[model samples]
Target: MATKTADADLKTASVLAFERKLDPSDALFSAGRWDERDDPARWAPVPVREKSVRGTISNRLKAKDQDPAKLDAQIDKPNLQTVDVAALPADADTLKVAFTLRVLQGAGSPSACNNAAYQAKLRQTVEGYVKAHGFIELARRYAHNLANGRWLWRNRTGAEEVEVRVQHLVQGAPATTWRFDALKLSLRHFDAPGEMTETLDEVAQLIARGLSGESHVLLGVSAFVRVGAGQEVFPSQELILDRDSTKKSKTLYTVADVAGMHSQKLGNALRTIDTWHPEAATLGPIAVEPYGSVTTLGKACRQPKEKQDFYNLLDGWLLKDRVPAPEQQHFVMATLIRGGVFGDGE
Candidate 1:
């Protein structure tokens, strides 16, 4: 069977100006599955194309019912120019891809999304501080994830070689774009190869100061993607990410989802430098917020403890517990005496 040519498989999309980041606020992680995709097969076959990729302007602050991240449900069509890989010069020696991280608007601004109450004064205050401080850190982490090919889940494993250049906007103009091939040095067999790590910290620290309204900073990412036979290029793909995955284990991040692990997983990889997450700056360790332990979401809700020490120990003991609990003692003994484990009360 003829396979899709490497060039035909290369897909790309540039999210129009919006503060984008996949920090903890994204709620992308879970206890059973990993990445933004809850599907068992993380990567799916998407026809590569370029068009005006429009979406709703919202965040996951209210993941559940109140502040659902549904764009069409809340606001009208938000303009997003999505440039497909095919639109770019394909015949060139190497496919040079360029992405811009422009500071579109702040979470405090009323033009951010639909509801003003959602971006109310309190949310604005908290959102501003987060944008100014940890956005760079979050951006660095995102760059690291991208540089290392962490988002290449299944279809596009790793590229033979990749080059990346990062630049920050200054004085209403961008500085010279600096190319870095260091991400190719990323090491971790059985995992995504050619990860850009050693260079990420350096890139993260490049912009030391936090953001301010007056600051018009833009992070530009330009790289070359190869689409040769037996070669793979993992470009960004826009997909539907559902936050509610109660029916399956693949939804939660593989029962071992943690901060670093999820941070590295794919699915809508890194998009923009800033995000609408309320507290994207100071976030705590990986945890189950609405469920896994039961709270306001519902008293019966109990999400698995993927990282908590107590549950980790219990799971370990359960695996080694050859003997069943008292409730199962009668069943065990009856199985030996009778043909099957019938009744314990008898």
Candidate 2:
């Protein structure tokens, strides 16, 4: 058929890439009194300390190693190891996590695209989607993630109190500020309860404007976690490969000797909004990856065979001129916003 010939001629771009729009700086950790939260400047930086501990033989042993004599020998061998840790000083009851985020514009515009026609069609499709649905849903989910302090990660567990403050920065000062009782917001869903809806809407609108190229949006986020004096706080761990056996077994992240989390980790938490993938009903929302990959779960929800992965959906839309369903449109757009190298192979 003529249609088949045309399709065959219209190959995917050999070089297509997009830069990430939601940018976040490294999150630095500080410690202070719950009452002294008003003066974050006075807070002391939480420092990573090296600790030595004998490892416990608690891991499940292989069937062959389950022999009582072998197990006893393993337990007798001291697994001495040194690791890095971060904890609040005895005088401090709250951990202050601070970071900055910049929301850049241009969601679907590829930074590199060899195929001009495909690029044009892609832009047109993105513009159409923008006109029809806008970025409200995506923006709202991002705002929810901020309000809930999802970026706090392991430090959020069993906290006596958690407060998140988001400030819209303009000209180096706060133009608008929103304070959230982070514990009250559920992490499982994007919905904001009635009382927080108005505030959440304001934040979402600002994010939407940023994504739509209406304005530059910069946010300063500070989370105060009341984990009690001397309680341990969690910072991102460093992944050391091909390590020397004598080196520290665990290494935590730090910025200038201050405990910190990676910007990539924070960005991952912010974009955890892909609930439209096929397995979402049972698996819940996941970070918006092209393959709907949940690294922690070791599963890819958007399988190619299901024709739900980004390439399949995107090729169908741009090459075949088949507009996907509303939810799928959102997924595709969200993936564009997430941004990455997505070129087709020659």
Candidate 3:
């Protein structure tokens, strides 16, 4: 991968970057409350507010006609969980991707919280965790999402491209600005390899060090996107709707929508280090991740007319009794996630 790193000579608008906080709507970190035992390394599927992954995942259960009460409890549990592997078929694609999760909230005194000491402690702890291993599983899913065109529709709503920026706050120097591609920071999978390339490891290590809270360091992420002709994109949060049926168009929707779009543009910001609660995962070379590693999910674009049927068909396959072929299951789930639930019903 191509890479570049500069000293304090760079000056850019990233000095006022905004953090793209994590959306806890996924199978991992969805529980409303945080459990101290929950590790950033391993996570389980839990019932989320979103309809796509809500409630019990019947397709992954091993026992036929499993107890409904037990299923509900599993969804409610706030600790690490072992999924019923027997319920699902084995997958052949075992690939792992690496990403560095570092803290961007330390160089400057954190003003987000009232307790200065607590904020500093929190930043150091997070920096330590990100440097130790970073997140692999989440990185893979994010790569999967990125590769699949998950945010394309909304992103395409505006003809304009977006620019993402990272602010590097030194103790007493001007902040530096950079992009993921420039830093060679991207979600890459290596199926045919003995170890990560020396260059990639070097970049990851450098990022980890920069993210370290050794000295007063402040980090923030921001973006710039302009629309072209024949299309329009507005901010998501700018529009106020009393109900879901309010008029809708090519508007951007919410800051989350913009952040999501920026992540897509940045290439490496998929579930980046600034997420709310710690999350990440890793898979070995022999066994593919059980949930949805191999699939046609990212292969084809969803036709406008078939949006409703997309979820309907998936629900029938995964949430119901019709177990599909192993590869088919992966593709279905992958496509389901890649084609985000937003704007589908409309």
Candidate 4:
């Protein structure tokens, strides 16, 4: 009996899937005084309420409806629609958002896979990459996002001061805590500033350990934003499909009437660490995605034509035995850590 050649065994798995390593719960919103942040028990949940507002005809009229008289008549009738809104109380000067993140182990293992040969080969490949480079870079970037309050989204914009508290949870209690002056960190880059580098390293090490199957990591994150009294805050918008115009025009996400941000939204912010793509020099870091897609921009930074997308790099590395550059390898591994189904149709 002759041994099978390596080339013959190299093939793309038809059913391969990876589980996401970084999992976060929905962020709940609350209101309190900036000074009262130490006493979170007294904080009140931010409630989502409905309000009716007259819509202005700010949208450009079509050529057919551009007539001055018709436009005046249309403007005269108030476009009344009900929308949901959340705001801080007049007495409250701060908004507090809290969430839990669970970091699981087994970064390269596939949750679902059919081909044993391909799975074994892929595992070996990932192991090789791990031996060459650890997950510190990726982990550090994630830590930066958490510390900088990137998950606060619009709420962080006009905040007079923003503070983030990250606690290492053990047995449902904080074992260690790290505080960050969020506005001091820039979101455009992941460079660790001098003052916060040491603390960030500790957080990154925990996350990397979790990813490398060394330990399970649980983080409790709380962000406090001082946006002034009675200011409105933005929550995740509910995507309502197939609804009539008479229904509420806008819907804010809520958990038991308390305004909340979606877990998916928080996850997206955490994984916004893809800065190795071709256009990254000009576009800055984007969310870690297979295609380097930025939905808001309606463009993919890593185009297949450039052979930089996840699929292309993965196939070349596994099937063609063409190893990517160091930076590109990091991107590929980050995508795997991000997790997705990547199976060849053929």
Q: Global lDDT of each model?
A: 0.34, 0.92, 0.30, 0.91
| Top TM-score prediction, candidate number | 4
RMSD of 1: 24.9
RMSD of 3: 23.9
lDDT of 1 by residue, 1-346 (tens): 2323432332211111122222222112111111212243332221233345565556564546454445445666554544432221222223333445443323222223332332343243335345445345443544554454333333223444455556665765666455555345332321223343445655555532323234444665544433333222233332326635332212222122221123323323443121212222442111122112222234322223432222222222222323333312221111111111111121
**What are the models' TM-scores?**
0.35, 0.96, 0.27, 0.97
lDDT tens digits by residue: candidate 3, 1-346: 1211221221221112123322221101111112211243432212211112223443577684368887777777554322211000122111111112233323222324443333444344334434543433233444333332223334323323333334444664336644322112222332212232443333333343433333333443332323332222221122345545543322232232121222333332242221111112332111112122223334222232442233343434422434444333333332322223212121
| 1 or 3, greater by TM-score | 1
Instruction: Please give the distance, in angstroms, between residue 258's alpha carbon in candidate 2 and its true position after superposition.
Output: 0.6
Query: What order do you get sorting by TM-score, best first?
Result: 4, 2, 1, 3
After superposition on all CA atoms, what RMSD does each candidate show versus the true structure?
A: 24.9, 1.9, 23.9, 1.6
Candidate 4 per-residue lDDT over residues 17-114, each given as its tens digit:
99899999999999999999999687999999999998888897799899999999989989889999999999999999999999888888899989
Clash pairs, candidate 4, are: none
Indicate which candidate wins on lDDT. Answer: 2
Model 1 regions more than 4 Å off: 1-93, 104-136, 149-156, 169-174, 182-202, 205-210, 226-267, 271-346
Q: Order the numbered candidates by lDDT, best leading.
A: 2, 4, 1, 3
124-195: candidate 2 lDDT, tens digit per residue = 889899999999988999999999999999999999999999999999999999999999998888878899
Worst ten in a row by lDDT for model 4: 1-10
